[model samples]
Target: MTSRHHNLQHLKNQAYQDPLTGLPNRRSLGDYLQTALDRLHRHAGQAVVMFCDLNRFKEMNDTYGHTVGDRLLVAITKRLQAALRPDDVLVRFAGDEFVVVLEQCGSRQQALAMAHRLKKQVGSTLHVDTAVLQPRISIGIAMTSDPLTAAADLLHQADLAMYRAKRQKGDSVEIYDPVLDD
Candidate 1:
């Protein structure tokens, strides 16, 4: 590719990717989710958003330091990427938090199943330097077949469900229910 084209691609990656984990950042998530929602409107498929937050992540950072915490986050990102399908979108939403968008998911049950797999994969023990860590994540999932649903609404619902899961003890997955909003 031309150097100018390469520079443009580089700029795009910097804009969209998390520096520590190389996962897509929140800006990319917004674009990808909106596109998925639009496609769902035209077709007969569902899209799922999973909000995942690391449990007791602050404790880890306080105890181990940010460098170690950064390493752990990068390791966790790799595990999560491995567990997801090739087409799934994984975004590093913020510190100790990530979002996964599954497009063309068949049903809520399928989304739930995917969430379970993610929880298991991330919960596995790992060694970063001398510190041994067993990471746990609370996952909240929201699935929609409705084309009229706004991407932000879906993300908000999933985030709400994730908070509910975190309250129940870490490392669990909860599906967003409409009742949860009330």
Candidate 2:
């Protein structure tokens, strides 16, 4: 049946998504980020790439079944989306990692504020299914003032900042090392 086909397609899309969170997988994140970067470049504007990794996900996952973990991820994803501005994007990069893009950010301050908001959102306790989930996200902000920075480079910068964020706690948001080689 036609309805069956539509359902199947939807299922297929979900399969590529993070089963735990129902957010786009890293594979799709790469594609979408690239597309956004390209569009920004064409428009001669800056793009802000942010990487978010949950702080206490592994502890929760080991303590609970994947079902509970998945539910928690879903709740976290919704919270992140709700916190983002209309022009920004939030993606599930991986297990506890997420990627966000702020199109045409006017300043580092703007990016900083977004990261702080995301950190607060993720840090909030969530009621997922039958349990409460506590988690925080470390945010990494990468801003490219140059319109020519390719998508791959933008991702690389965001990833580097993500590691910097992981070194600490609560809410760490670091700008990319502009001095680094491209």
Candidate 3:
């Protein structure tokens, strides 16, 4: 490839990737969701957005140094990637918060099953330099077959659902409902 083409590709990757975890960033998520929405308009499939937040992450960071926190984040990212399918998109949305886009998911049940698997994977114990940490995560899932749905709106629904899950016991999963939006 030409040097100019290589440079452009590198810049594009840096723009869309999270520097810390090496996962896709929010911008990449937006682009992927837009493409998925367009495909759904012509196809018959469901998309699910899963918003995940680590429980007591701040405390973990406070107790352990920032280096340890960073290590934990990288570890969690690897586990998440391992648990997901090749077509699934996982992005590090923000500190201790990640989003997974399940493209062409068959149904709500299938999405929930995916969420449970992620939660189980994250709940596993981690050994960070003799500090055995058991991390818990709360997940909110929003699935839609609606072609008109905007990516931001879908993400908002998932975010709201995630808050609801966090309000309950940690490591819980909640599906988006219209009532939750109210």
Candidate 4:
């Protein structure tokens, strides 16, 4: 490739990727969701959107410095990536929140299983330098096969589900239901 082409590609990557976690940023998530919606519209395939929030993240940040918090975030990112399939897309939404897009997810059960796997992986103890920290996450899942569903709607549903999970006793996962919409 030409030097100019390479530079442009690098710039595009930087624009879409989170600097700390190296996961896709929100902008990239929006674009990818649009494509996923279009594909679902065409093929009537199932896709799942998962919203994850770290529990007690602010407390962790307050106890440790941002430097340590940043390292913890990176560690969590690696675990998330490892838990997902190659085709699944993980986006660093903001701060301690992440969005995972699972394309061609066969069913809600499959998505829920994936969420459990991620929650288990993230809930493990993390060691940074001499400090050991236990991380917990609440996950919300929204599965869609409808062509008419909007990306924002899906995200909102997932967000609400995540909040519901957070309210529970431990690191939990909740699937979005019609009741959540109301």
* Model 3 agreement with the true structure over 54-150: per-residue lDDT tens digits: 9998999999989889999999999999899998999999999999988888888899899999989988899997678999999999888987899
| Model 1 spans > 4 angstroms off | 1-5
Residues 1-182, candidate 2, lDDT per residue (tens digit)? Answer: 99999999998798667766666777677666766667765675568899888877888888877778877778788989989888677778777788998877777887888888888877777876667777777777787767567777788888888777778554577777865434
Badly placed stretches (over 4 Å) of model 2 are 1-16, 42-44, 129-131, 178-182
Local lDDT at 106 for model 2:
73
For model 4, the run of ten residues with the poorest summed lDDT: 36-45
Clashing pairs in 2: none
Q: lDDT of each model, Cα atoms only?
A: 0.92, 0.78, 0.91, 0.88
**Candidate 2, which ten residues in sequence have the lowest lDDT sum?**
173-182
Model 3 lDDT-worst window of ten: 32-41
Strongest candidate by lDDT: 1
- Would you estimate the TM-scores of all the predictions? 0.94, 0.82, 0.94, 0.92
Error (Å) of candidate 1 at residue 64 is: 0.9
Q: Which pairs in model 3 have colliding backbones?
A: none
lDDT of 3 at 48: 86
